[model samples]
Every structure is written in C-alpha cells, then in structure tokens.
Target: MKLARLAGPTPVRDKILAIFPGALGDFICFLPTLDKLTRDGEIDLFTRTEYGDLLPASVRMRSLECYEISRLFVSGVEEEEKLKRFFAPYSRVYSWMGSGQPDFVRNLTLLSNGKLKVFPFRPSVSRIHITDYFLSCLGAGSSDEITPHIPIRADALAWSGRLWQQSDLERKSVLVFSPGSGAREKNWPPDFYATVAEWWEKKSAGKNLAVLGPVEEERDKISGRGDRVLALRGLELGRVAAVISRCDLYLGNDSGVTHLAAAIGAKTVALFGPTDSVQWAPRGKRVTVITRNVECSPCLSPVMKSCLHHKCLTALSPDYVIGRLEELLG
Candidate 1:
C-alpha cells in the first residue's frame, strides 16, 4: 500500500508487534493509529496492563495480549532481550513509541543485532504531535490525514446501556465531569471543577460527573450531590471509555482521561495548569484548552521539573470554565 512507502524493502507484514507501555489516555490516543492498521496484519500489542482493554475493537481482535513492560520506557541490551523474546517468531515489529519503548521496536528489525538496523526516523525530528509520531512509525503519511475509527465494543455498549437503566438518570443531554488528572501539581482546583460541574448540571439537566480514574477519595469530597456522580475508579479501562463516550461533553485536567474524551469524540474541555498546554493539549479532536498563559505558566512541562506554587491552575476559575463550556455547548 502507499502507506507502506517508508518500509524500504522489508517484507509487507512480518508478524507485526506494536508497543505502547504508558498511561491509559496515552494508549487510547494511539488507538486511532491502530485503527488505520485495521485487518492489515496480525498485530501484537505490548502496553501497560491497565490499558489492555482501552484499545479499539478492530485492533484488539487482531491478536496478542498486552503485558506490563515497565513504568518508564528504558532501553538497552536487557530491554532488547525482552524484545528478542517477544519477536522471536515475528520478523517485522514496530513499537509505536514517541516516549514509550522505541528501542525494543528498533532492535527487533535489526540485521546484525543492531549493527544493520534501520528505523522510520531521522535527525531534527523531536517533540512532534503524538499521533504523527506513531503513524510515521507505521508508514502512514501525516497524523492529520484523518484516519478511520473503530466502533466501541458490543459488550461495552451493553454494559453502558445497563448502567443507564440502573441509574435514575434521564439520559438527557449528559455532561460528564472527569474531575481528576495530572496529579495535584497540574490539576486545577477541585472547587473550580465543582463550580463548572454545578453549572453544567444546572444547564444540561442529566449532567453528572464520571469521576474517571482512581478518584474514589476525591469523589467523596464532592458534597451537596448524592447521585450526580459515578465513581468509575473500579470500572475497567474499556468501561471508562464507553461511559465517557455516552456523554455530550467532558471537562477535566490536562491529563490522560482528558485525552481519552477527545479520542472518543466527546467535546472535551481540558484545564491546563503547570504543563505546557501547547504540546500536551488534546490532539486534532474537538477540545478547548483553558489556560491563563501567565508569565510563569507551563513551567511544569517547559522549563522546571515541577512548580513550587501552582498559581497557574488556581487562576482557572469556575466562571472561566463555565464561560468556555457555554460557548462549547452552544
């Protein structure tokens, strides 16, 4: 295919294996690229254990199991040994890595044990968009080329349907508030989130909080509402994505779940604090990034390791988010 023009002279499909050992949202973000490979090859995935279910339906059916590789993407002979074991049968392996295990993917496509190895990359290429980086690896032209998306799993749809039946919610214009992400450092104030949620609840009527990720402790602090929020901490990764897909709008910190919302086609509102909102903001999808753009803003991802006083997030008020939501919802 024209997409495989970057393959040089290698075989079309050498038992392809893709790796993306990272956060759930990050993995979900890669699903679009995975979708493009739909029915093209017998793909094996090596991602974080938690995100095993987050992959798209078409991609997931291909093959292989997702095992936890490592928390951080480290590379070396030892890591090469792991790839050596994984790709023993597969001749062509590609790890979709911008920050994940690129080395493992690179080492497998070697001729003289890394001496005659070739990769789909060149110098002066760094800090590209996440989707572009991966699609480039798989020989796709540009990430902006607008690829096809796989449908949600049938099981997930049935599960989500049952959830609606179980709840007293009217299933009206739903607004799902993902009130957690990016840790306390990059997270906008919880009260700020509460204020936005309150406004959305009033406006959207059937609006409620999804409380995505491990937000059980935080969900308890959401006073004045009993059934308005659903703690999805116990829900599996696929379940979380399905629930978010059911929403009309999603709002959250600039974190993985925010990206998941964008991936699933929800009109996402992501709050940016210490992180570089420019680079970390949700991709091509419909997303509105709310940041103050202060003098010291984007300090977390730009310059410093972490900011001491997180005024950037504090500056993001409820009124501000609600204003953005009003525009987005309209």
Candidate 2:
C-alpha cells in the first residue's frame, strides 16, 4: 500500500490572464477562447472597463488600467521590476493588444524573464472567421462554428422591459434595427433602412425599434417616421444586447452591434458592402449576410475606397432585402 502511494509533485491550477484592449467585436470574437479557458481554471480579462458589466460570468473582468500598464512595460517606460509584479500573479498570460505588435510581446516575455508564461495573439488567416483565429492564438484550436457569447445583465433586461412598456411595444413582435457602422459606406442607404423598417412593420405587424449609436446620431439619416417604428438612442451596449435578446429579429449593417445581436441569439440580417463578410460577418445559425457581389466589391478592408458611389450597398434594393426578411421571418 505504501509503495502504491508513491506521489508525484502536486499539480498547480492554472491562473490565466488575457489582455485584449480591443473593440466590442474583437472582444466578442475572443469570448469563446475565454469560455474554454474558464473551463480549465480561473481566468481574468483585461479589456475596456466600459464593457466590464457585460463580461462572462466565468471570467473576472480586470481594469483597463492593467492593459495600459502592460503597454508601458512593453514600451520600456516602466522598469522590469514593476512589470514583474504584474506578471507574477498569473501562471499564464495571453496578450492580444492589437495585431502587428510582436516587439511588444517580446518585451513582455523579456520583462517576465521566463518565469511567467506569456503569449501574443494575432490573426494569420484572412479567410477564416476571426473567432477561429482568436482561439488559435490561445492554443485553444479552431472551432468549426464561430459563435459569440454576450452576457446580458438583469438591470439591462429591466431597462429594456421598461423601454418597451414606455413605447407601447410590449405586446408586439419587436424587431430591432441598427443603421450604424464605423464607416459610412458599410451602411445601407438610410432610405433603404427606412423602407425596410416600413415593410417589416407591415409584414410582421410588429413594432420596429431603431437603435442608433453615437456615430449614427451625427448623420441623422436613419429614422422611422411613424409611431409604429420607435427610434431609440444613447443606449449602453449591454442594454442594447438585452433589447436584442428580447426582439424577434435584428437588422443591421456590418457593425459591432450586429455582432452583439447575433451573440445574444437574435435572428439577424447583416448587410455588407465593401467589407469582407467571410472574415467579419456576424456568426450564428440564424444570421443571414446580404451583399451584392461585384467584381470590385469586398475591398477586404474598412478603409473606404475612392469609388465615390458605393454601388455595392446602394445597388442592394429594398425589395431584395425584403425578400430575405420574408425568409427569415417565415
């Protein structure tokens, strides 16, 4: 019995830290990796503090200041001794602080002096879904299905319920629409969105909720004229996610909020223009990506081309979108 009791060294549970100072979409893509890591052991996330309320229950959301400190450490503005303290707490650290920052990763590894396991994450495959790429960086391997997971808090749900009640949309099949993107060209013409809103309201006999972000407020183009379509603005990301989760369907451009809608399990129709849908489209079983495939379309980058007229977007008629909407709603 004693001979059988010969023991190996006690195993240590992995304490993981992930630094991703990125936007909402980027962080959403990385969520599967975070979910996987949490199954193994404890994990902490260093992302935008503004999104702290929306992080997964499995991971601890650390302050954005931690990432800024990491940047300082990489830049050599802070000494190794101070930076070592930051690295010492975690058994492994995954830094995905934007792509093309190899030097920063190397600096972080050096500062840790081989005592900490530090890894830098970047996307290599342009064709694959970004979730797959993010998972690869964490050595989590690739998933055939790339779905985003967003957590909606109780306060947000309550807020959304209140908003719906106030707008007299509580009893209707609520359809949420977002007409904003980082770039103007990625947006389907405002008239197209308005037309879709009007048609959707008529078909589903549902109330349309137009949720616009700060970028949209300035343009002031996408709007619903009647009481049947309510225009909501200045909502927090978490609140928007909660509202989308309650909605029957989501219609939006290729934007972060579109990704958010898909993550929260809303059936989504994502309009695409010059941007690459293969790489950036919202991933979900119920998601439909509509694009007019032109020879020069899908510039594969967000940087708007000099093609003054965005035919890729403008050419997509309201009738075509309505046909897709029928399929989704049916």
Q: Model 2 over residues 1-330: C-alpha lDDT tens digits?
A: 456667899777788877777677777777787787787778878778877766777678877775544574456633556666766777676676633565565666665554334444545556777888777765666655758777679999998888878878777888889888777668888888778778877876888888887775423655537565677787778888888988888989988889888888889889988888888888888889999887677784434656687888887899988988787667
Assess the local accuracy of residue 293 in candidate 1 as a C-alpha lDDT between 0 and 100.
87
Q: List per-prediction Cα lDDT, in the order shown.
A: 0.61, 0.75
Residue-level error in angstroms, candidate 1, position 231: 3.2
All models, RMSD in angstroms: 7.0, 3.9
Provide TM-scores for the models. Answer: 0.75, 0.87
lDDT of 1 by residue, 95-158 (tens): 4443324654444435123322223422235456565655666667764545323346678878
